[model samples]
Target: MDEAALREMLDAVRSGAMTSDDAVAVLRRLPFADLGFARVDHHRALRLGMAETVYAPGKTPEQCAAIVAELLAQPGSSPVILSRADDEQAAAALAANPGGARTRATVVWRPAAERAERVVVVTAGTADQPVADECACTLAAHGFRPVRISDVGVAGLHRILDAVEELATADAVVVVAGMEGALASVVGGLTAAPVVAVPTSVGYGASLAGVTALLSMLASCASGITVVGIDNGFGAACAVVRLLPSAVTTRV
Candidate 1:
């Protein structure tokens, strides 16, 4: 449960609305919920200002669905992120438990309050959208607005320049690129905000399936940018969320 729910439970007990025993039952699940495969960390919301995220890549669809179901059963309304979810797995899980017509495991959550301090997710081209989408999804789940600038690679410098205003105001920038991955360095030159470069496995034989891009990003002359694992959009997003101010309230 989140802080709001915890407060409400205590307030009810203090005002004679809820019995002490009943409150005890409510508080019992604060730390976690024991699923056979995973101990769902429910307390993360209280500690990190964000709910525990589900990583759907290595897990079976049923396992992923079960974890999400447990989280949805919590007392407070908070956003959850499921990273790298398999399309088929997500469909099956959502079909089994449609989230009360309001929520969708696939439908990302966006906060209206953070429209101004939104993160800019710049993609080198269409091939990078999947990794870019992963980054954007994580940011959305964590209550930050993410604006997409597609196909604006170093090859097309003018396209990126057109978005100077949006780039300037962004809290952080996530640059998803493959091939030479030169976009990150160019973006780093332009923006003062921290740039998180993600090298995707979207290159030719000589590119070494992103090894070249990875090395290029690591060796960037840009002094202040950060680099994540190859195609680790979730890590990039988590970094962005840490840079953002603590969220004041849980979003429905």
Candidate 2:
């Protein structure tokens, strides 16, 4: 349960509106819920300042739908994010719960409450848009406003240069790229905000399925750049949220 729900429960008990036994019944399934195939963490928002997310790569559409349904049934569950979801999986999830919104490879169930902070998502090229969109969708699910900057790879240095002012205003930045991953370093140099780099598998043979880009990001000369695994847009978004100053107060 979220802090608001917990406080309401306690207040009800204190004011004689609810019995201690009644409160216990309400909190019986808290902390987590087991759904046969998956154990959904119901208290992640309380513990980590963010809710649990569903990664939909290996699971079938039915499995993903079942997990999302369980999460939605909780009393104070935060918005659920389904990352790396294919078209069929997205369709299934949306069919199960019409409240969710879908991008290319990500689905988000954002709550009505909105976050004040904004994050900038910069992609190296058009090919990186999928990963960048995933990062943006994930950030939105976590309550951050994501501003997308597309096709700003190092090859076209002027493109990112033009976005420097805009990027600097964000609470954090997520740079998505492949092929050497120099965009992260460039973005790092331009913005004072924390940079979370995501290397995608968007390059040719020498890229080694983004290993080259991953290594380049890892060895970045930029002062304060961090890197996630290849095509891990969700993880990069989470890192950006963690880096925000108000994340503790804006618990997802």
Name the lDDT of candidate 1: 0.78
Residue ranges of candidate 1 with Cα displaced over 4 Å: 100-116, 249-252
Per-residue CA lDDT of candidate 2, range 102-150, in tens? 7887877855266787788989999998888878877777777788899
lDDT of 1 by residue, 159-240 (tens): 8888888788877999999998989998998888889999988888888888888999999998878888888887888777
Report the number of the highest-TM-score candidate.
Answer: 2
Model 2 C-alpha RMSD to native = 2.3
lDDT, residue 114, candidate 1: 44
